[model samples]
Each structure stands twice: as structure tokens, then as C-alpha cells.
Target: MSRTPDFLAQGHDERDPSPWLALYLDQSTPLPDEVKAAWLTDSSSGSRQYLLPFLRPVARLTIILIQVVKVFVPRNWSHSKLLHRLLAWGLKRFVSPEANWLILRHFHLGSQVLGFIGRNSPAPVGTSPLEPADIDALKDETFLKHDLNLFNFVIRLNQALRDKGLVLGKAPQVDFSMIRDPGLRLSDMPHGKLNFLDLQSAIELFTPLYQLMLTDNDFWRAANSLQLDETIGIYAATLLGAPEHLILVNNKHPLVPLSTLRAGHRLVIHGLSTEMLHSLLRRMQAAHGATPTPEQPLA
Candidate 1:
């Protein structure tokens, strides 16, 4: 027998293979002598042959269906009282004891064993971070999907703030020259950057203007305004359009519903303190029939 199995020799990262990989291995890779012997000993009462082909495509299909249901049904719907009752009835009537046993032992137990082995395995060394150019390229591709340019919006907002005679307590952390200059191309603008001060400045200027526009309030005549507050608000919520660094979900800030968070929706509460913001979030959640809990993740 070959000392190194094909599964082990596969050019996967030295770090643990995923749960899916483990399932694939369980089907393809031969079991160790100890494991087979243990299975034989455990199967004294029932014939071992009866439990043959435990890792079937049928089992995988069942698991996949469960995942699809979870994905299509929003979390709130799944947790609803009516759905809970239906789920209980469905599981009891539809799922058999033998099927349950197979799921518990063959699928769950095997996956747990694979997970343990993977966790204990050594990680690969010398993996470098993504290059700055690569990061910039990704950002540019992402930004192309949206209509507004975030950096330019920020620079325009700063000018609006100055015109309005609003003095920020601190100067913005982001340099606006690259974006403010019409001579520079989009590629020449700062890459993969998001300064909090710049973000706050954009929020400060854009949100109030947006809210006013939403209400159709009379402040539609400011001299230095770009007439693009709606555009700025739309892009600001996505702010960098990077999921890993989302700002709207921050616990300290108010959460905005993505569907309603676009350009024209009500997104601002002028002079709202941090405490007031959290209070408003709870009220909003309650009004929407979503139970508010401290541990619940921001939407």
C-alpha cells in the first residue's frame, strides 16, 4: 500500500481542509484499520452490511435542501412562531428513526472527527498578503458598479461644509487633493482607503441634505451644494462597498435597512447622540415586529 494517500498528497493548503473536503474524503478515502475494526465491534447486534454506503449522494442532497431552505427563508421568518410549529411537525412525521441515526452517526460523527483532525493539523507558512495593486484593481472593479465616486463625493462634501460655515472639530484624516483635482484620473485617486474623519464628514454633510430632500424641506437653495446629496448618501451607506469593513453595521452607529437606505430614504437624525441612536434602533426594530435583543446582530 502507498504510504501517502492521494487525499493527503492533494495540493490543498497545509491548513485544515473544509467540512466539504472532509465529506469528499470520507466517501473516497479508505478507512483506517482501527476505525473499521471499531465499526465491526460496534455493529455486533446489527449486520454491518445493512449500513453499507452511508455516504450517499441522497444524503448530500438532503443536506443541500436544508441549506437552500435556510437561505431562501430569512432568519426572521424561520424564527417565527408559525414556522417553528410547522418545523416541529415536519421533522417528526417525515424523518425516520433510522434516517436520524444515519445522520447523527455517519454524517455528524464523521464530520466531527474530520474537523478535529483538521484543527490539529499544522498550518502552511509564508503566505503573503495581497498586493496593493491587486487590492486597488478589485476596488476599481467594484466601484464601477455604482454611479457615484466616493472620494469625489467626500471632497465635494467638505466644500459644502465650509460653505455652510460648519466647523468640524478635527480636520479630515483623508487627503482630498487627489480626488478634488479634475486633472487626475480615477486610477490616480487614493487606493483602498477609508478615513473615519472623511467618512464622518460625508455623513454629516450628506445625511441632513438627503433627509431634507426626502421631506422636500425648503433648504433646496444652498449656494455651494452640488445637488448630489442623494447620490452621496447612496454611496456612503456602501462606503467603500467592501463587506469586510461595513460601517452601517457598527454597534455604535444606527443600522440602516439596505433596501430603504438608498439615496432618497430617510437616513439622518440631526443632532442625535450615540445613546439616542441606539434607542432609535431598538424602537425601529420593535416597530418592524423584530424582537430587540442586546445580543442580536445589527441588520
Candidate 2:
């Protein structure tokens, strides 16, 4: 077989590829604004103007990198909408994964990963991180569709790993929750008056034994918060369809549900602290069928 592989050796006008190669290998080329324009075309509505803010930090440098050298350009090189993508792409292609383990030299991997899962930041793989506020501002369907993208990545990676004989059958860790909004009848679910139906509405959004939690007055008890939390918890447990022993559950921070507990419609709690649980039961005791008004400001 001839030494040069067919893939790399293409282009018949090979008057020595080396001299011609200087065109791309050169440094000091200028990065440009038009490149940004090329990328902005596809952004949703005014995403360009909104994304412009994050793009500024590395715009000039990225313009230079994108044009000047292959080593500098990110592997997924679409145009530079912002510096982060430039960094994400350049690092992924230029650096060897074998050497860097995801080329995470400058990033806090754990924090970024958490932000992706909870904050709804960072679409999987090549996508840029969205601002947390931006995420919340998104319509529920858009945000969740983005979230499922991340979930799919996890599932695929695990399948790849197992196929390679790496030997692990565990599905990725996940959490589920059912949270009651605070109010008369909203947050106040007495044992007898529980709205297992609406809870199912949320649960159906995420389902079937992945993991679960319930947030009650303990987490977001504005004051006189209702005690319908356990009712939600039991409801979630029933939805999980697991024997009690295998039902992974918790109620920490009651506000910020644990990271592992996400990927399901799990209740978000303010905290699972004793103060939270006590405050919840106290509200329950004070209830008189009519909901008590919440009085304390959140600490």
C-alpha cells in the first residue's frame, strides 16, 4: 500500500503541500467582526445582541485564533459567537484528550458540570453555557428540551463505556422531586386534602424510579407554610414504583435540590434543615382547614 492515506493525500495540485501549507500555519492574522456575523445568523431571535455580552471578553483574540492557525482554532470551529466556544472548540481539537482528560485545564469541571445540570447552562458537547437568568427566562419547554440534550449525552457516553468492556451497568445518577407552591391550598396540603392529581402533573414531567424528593414548608415556608410536604413525598414514592428499600430520596437545603436528584420533576427545597422540618409541622399544627397566612421573610 502507498504510504499516504487517501483521506489526507487529496488535492491533485500537490506542488509540495509544505510550501502551500504556510497559508494556514501562519500566525498574526487578524480576527474579524464578520465572523461573528456569520454565527449570529442562526441564533434565536435576538440571541446575537444578548450573546454579544459574553462574546466581548475574547472576541479579538478569538478572531485572531480562528483565522491564524489550526492549532488555535477550536475543533468544532463554526464561527466565533463568543470566546467560550472558541476555547471549547480549540481545546477539544488541538489538545489531545489522552493528555488532558477533556482539556479542562482552565475550567472547574465539577462546577461547570453542576451548572450544566442545575442552572440549565451549557448545552451538551459543543454548545455554549447560557446564563442562569436566561435559562429561567426561557419558556419551560425550551429549557427542558435543552436539559434532555444533556441527559442524552450521559446516556450515550455510558453506553459507549460499557460497550468498550469497561464494565459498569449503573445508569447515570439522577434525582426526582415534587414541590408544592406556597399558599392557601397551594402550599397547604393537609393529609385529607392532598392534590395527588396536580402532583402527578409535575411527576409526569419526569418519571419512573430514577430518584425523588418533596419540598414542603421546610424549604420555602414563607411562614405559616402548609405541611403538605409528606403527602407529596408519599405521592412521589408511589410514582417511583420501587420497593421502599430502593427508593433513593432526600430533602436537603430543601430549596436547592441535590444535583444528583435532578433529571426528574423532583421538588426543589430551600433546605432540609431541622428548622425547616419544625417550621413545617408548626404550620400544620396551626392550620384550621383554612390556610394560615405566611408572615416571615425568607432568611
The numbered model that scores best in TM-score is 2
lDDT tens digits, residues 1-299, model 2?
A: 11222223444345656432232233222111221111112121132335434433343344334334544534444321232233333323332221112112111221122222232211212223322222122222322223343344345434655566553222142221111112211111111222112221222222211111112211122111112233223322332232241122234333343323132223322112112332332333234232323342111
Question: How does each model score on TM-score?
Answer: 0.17, 0.19
Model 1 pairs in collision: none
lDDT for model 1 comes to 0.27
1-299 in candidate 1: lDDT tens per residue?
A: 11232333463654866443344346232333323222222232132223323323333344345445545554433222332244223323333222212212222221221221122212201111111222122222221211123223345445655676653232222111111101112222222212111212222233332322221111121211222323222322222222322222232222322322221212112111111222233333345455423232111
How well does model 2 score by local distance difference test?
0.26
TM-score of candidate 2 relative to the true fold = 0.19
Count backbone clashes in candidate 2: 20
